[model samples]
Target chain A: MPGQTTASLPRVAITTGEPAGIGPELTLMLAMQAATLPAQVVAIGDPDLLSSRARSLALDIDIVPCRPGDDLPAPQAGRLSVWPVSLRAPSLAGTLDPANGAYVLDTLDLAIAACRHGQASAMVTAPLHKGAIIDGGHPGFTGHTEYLRDACGVDEVVMMLATDQALHGVAHGDTSCPLRVALATTHLPLRDVADALTAERLERILRVLDGDLKRHFGIVSPRILVCGLNPHAGEGGHLGREEIEVIEPTLNRLRTEGLDLTGPLPADTLFTPRHLATADAVLAMYHDQGLPVLKYAGFGRGANITLGLPLVRTSVDHGTALDLAGKGTADPGSLRVAVSLAADMARHGQ
Target chain B: MSQAQPCIALTLGDPAGIGPELVAKLLEQRDVVGKANIVVVGDRWVWEEGQRVAGIHHEIPEISSLAEARDQTGPVLLPTSTIKPEDVEYARINGLCGTSVLEVLKLCMDGASAGQVDAICFAPLNKLSMKQGGLKHEDELHFFVDHLKVETPVCEFNTLGNLWTSRISSHIPLAEAASHVTSERILSATQLIHDALIAAGIEQPRIGVAALNPHAGEGGTCGREEIDIIAPAIDACRDAGYAAQGPFPADTIFRRARDGEFDGVVTMYHDQGQIALKLMGFERGVTVQGGLPIPITTPAHGTAFDIAGKGRANVEAMRHAFDIACRMGRHHASR
Candidate 1:
């Protein structure tokens, strides 16, 4: 506790995502047990929604109202600080409404603004309903990472998921460190993944991944394991030629530039402990190739971090469980880990 | 099976690969003897080579025939072919090694058909060698389907502990994977895994179907494959009286299955399930040749030609494959 004084704790802005979903309750759950974390979390959503959810969940967290740049107090048990953004319409648990779409984006904007203005060290987001947001107005909204990338005016950002839990692969033995999986292509259809993985894009993604592992995660020279775009990594051009034509050349180029990168290896064999034990992270060709293993290894406890951003940001690895909204049954494990990771990243960046 | 000890035929998979060492290591285990009445159905010289390379030995009773193996309680070697160990190469794709491997597997299949053996489990085999050895089919699953001579539908089911996965498409380009995600294929895959689960002793297996697109097509915004293809197939599967859910996102379906939300997963592509299953438990994964009349299983890995003769092969998957064969053999016997 000597080193973890109030002044030393990083301030993390927690955006309570979809109002009708589990975000409000998960935020309250995290705030109720906030004393255990290394950061001071400020919830950036409607205060009325928080209070109502708290009452409904029977959590006795005292909602202390504050602004983003206000001198934040140290986290205490049963006390939570809030930077309130008013909701357009009242929301009920497990119900979706069109009016609250802009409110969700408003909360994210405030969190981004806080992080950019140095008012907060990092931001952790709860899950928001993409459908509700689209129905509420903006049809082009894909995900929080893209929205943040556009809001921050960055050309690229890497989506990396990590958990500190060791992958005891039952029989392949254990990984010594956390399993981190980053995607070269995030949310594309299966058919488009091959075309999306150009050499130029791969080089840029690798640079972002390598640079962020240094600048944010404190890894000096991160070792990355990359997966091939095809099955058996094209089986030496018999299955598909992306590995030979694209992934191999790109990795070789990056290696010449003195980045520690390994393989255009088979995706099926890439996630095992033998390959994972010494590596810092795995760069998969597509979303499903990397994340299924990452999510399986660290389900409900993994935190998703956006790399190459101007400010540190982390989020829960799950979607908003509308059915569990206001029921006090949502798991706060991922959110807590996200907050802790953001705090660590913030401190590491300093 | 009537004597409460189901007989199983085991083969040293590609002789040049780690299969021999793995089988040798497996024979050295004490618990394996009590699990099944195993008869090593490969050449005696190759078996000896495996034992020598693995630095372990067990005195398995040598028998000239399968009938002789049935009378013994402990493991026995049938000695199908005799080839000098010096003539064989380790890890390379040789036609002779592949032909010998196939001959041994064929003997086991014939044994199962003739009621001499209840199930079959082999060590890791090399597909390239098998291809060189005149394996006309895509892989062994097709060979099994063809040899068994009767098939409604069949697929390779990769199991890691209680969670099992069957993909609708495998070994093809990822570009062509989307084309194979038709309702007919999904239903067949769903039905195949369901019946296989039942045969393996799980009654009423709950199968979770995976979407081909990322984020499950995002309600038709990102891709419509989930809405137009996967979801309809899931509906068709349900209508056919199978307990299946999803068109869930491929990335999270395995996680839910791992957590026991479902007993099996039907993946739309090869790596969707493979990436997760191998990551979860690589050394313990078992590949079951689903829809065959007889229970057949092998390690869900290939011959580690790189570490073949070094005797560094992990025999965990081999042991698990044997255990699964035993479980399924009991069910097959009862049926």
Candidate 2:
């Protein structure tokens, strides 16, 4: 439970994901840099585990243990603020133990509760090994984003990977440069991407993407580019006609609603440097179709953000590297970016 | 060879496939080196083994640069390999062989970018073989696009008898393929095909757009895609000065186009055009990446991993790929 008071600072709950992965290391790394962050950050995991991780990584951070109803501690210069949620069993550095799955879930549940009760302004989640989490009896949790969605009771969410590129601006300011992409359908088998692209679904996704871009990134009217489902966008029915029959009408409908949108362009050609330079974001047809390009563009440095959620949430665009766990060598660049994005979005005040 | 022209970097596709054999058979053509410089971008041992199996006696040109083969006659080989040729077993997917193939493509593309090579032609590479090679891309073309960061729309065009260019869906699931058909996409594909044909020097190319459902939806009784969506798009393209016609029954459209009824056919999905074109002239089929700054052409077949190490691969498609690449390259160069 979080402290209740008017003066209680808004907390940003961080879930140190799967116990045996790089989650603990990344959490410790971010904790080292917590002094520079603006929001109140809290890690819902064991304090001793974080301390051990910090020691292994050669990081010096004090661990402030808190119980339920305890006042959130002011983040110290070289210390980690922890809301202790003990693990059931001892965790090995590289091996995933099924016994700690409930502990991971409990951490997330506590963080979500903090956000729901207005104790936390937003949440930054570390990577979790989905397979281990599933094998640990929490059969429904697929990935961190899905788990967050269900925990927050959001009906639908779009995953966007954002990165910044320098551009000639009107003034000497850190321009709010973001390359945002939202998928019409995600995590589906490749065979199902086309049938799943309905006009209604596409319209909804575009609308949500537009709204989120405005709210989170402060783009007044973000230009949305769409990739066609078929090859050559159906080659006028030569390759496939999903573009002609399905995608066009949906775009037409969106156009009538006055959205700045373009395409049904061939997916193969949509990711070129010239075209990508002209649009604010791209709405990809499916997972593999769009993500390969995005991942290629910003592999380990991109941040995964969930739109259409009630609270601000951003995460590292990577999975729990069980192999690299406990090595104290996990890259904290993405975690730092996720925290920065969460703070930025919170400042924007959706 | 005539003035030692720049070699067209060619990739010997899958080791288990027909790529090695195809390269062997292609090199046997005396006139191939006469057209443009040819460089085989693959393992030297693989080429030698292919030469032995194909029973073609030709000296493998061992040179680092295309300029080295400038005055010499016969095909030049720029050997690239990740593993020993002896290590690759036929018909089996080997990650090393796949990675080698990708490395070859990357090297060739790099050379082309630096003006070291004039153009490139690819032999078929198996998708599964590439997966074994640890490639994360959907296809070779996608890999190129990612590497180059090309902005122009790279579309796959299959030229059947130099008469029609067809495609709709290239690589996607069938269920998803149908829903992707849209009026705007049809219009864009029609526009690109029309522009490609005109650029190929055809004036006002006649294009036939195929219907998604059977019989152009039999006037909406069979399906509404033709009546409700496709027909309107065809009309829009016509208004834009393209001689586009269709929502024709997919079954008969290809035949009509074959009979000189239309200059090209707009297909609804991958197999729709591929089936007709492959049947018409599978051996002579050529693939063109339209809307690219440079016209990129390749043989339609992939590396035949099964017969790759053996020298039984056909060279007709490779020959056609070269012919088309040369023609397109010349056309673009002149422009």
Candidate 2 structure quality by residue, lDDT tens digits, B23-68: 7788778777677766777788777766676777677667776545
Give each model a TM-score: 0.89, 0.54
Q: What is the Å distance of residue B7 in model 1 from its true position? A: 4.6
Give candidate 2 regions above 4 Å deviation.
A1-11, A67-77, A166-177, A298-300, B1-335
Residue-wise C-alpha lDDT for candidate 1, range A159-208, written one tens digit per residue: 99877575663222222127778999988888888788889999989999
lDDT of 1 by residue, B1-335 (tens): 43477888899888899988888999888888888889998888888889999998888778887766566778999887634567688878787787887888888888898888889999888777777777887678888888889657888899999988898987778888888889999999999999888877789899999988888888876778898888989999999999999989876787788789998899988888878888778889999988889999999988977788997999999999999998888778777
- What are the lDDT figures for the candidates, one per model? 0.86, 0.71
Candidate 1 all-Cα RMSD:
3.6
What TM-score applies to chain A of candidate 2?
Answer: 0.88
Instruction: State which candidate has the highest DockQ.
Output: 1
Candidate 2 lDDT by residue in tens digits, A1-350: 13433233346778898888888888888777766665567788988788887777788888888754566766656777788899888887888888888888888888778777766778888877766778889787677778777877877789887654421112112333455567888766334556778888887888889888788777788788898876546545544677888889989988898888889876644555445677778898865455544443332356788888878888887778888888877888888777777767776764
lDDT of 1 at B317: 96
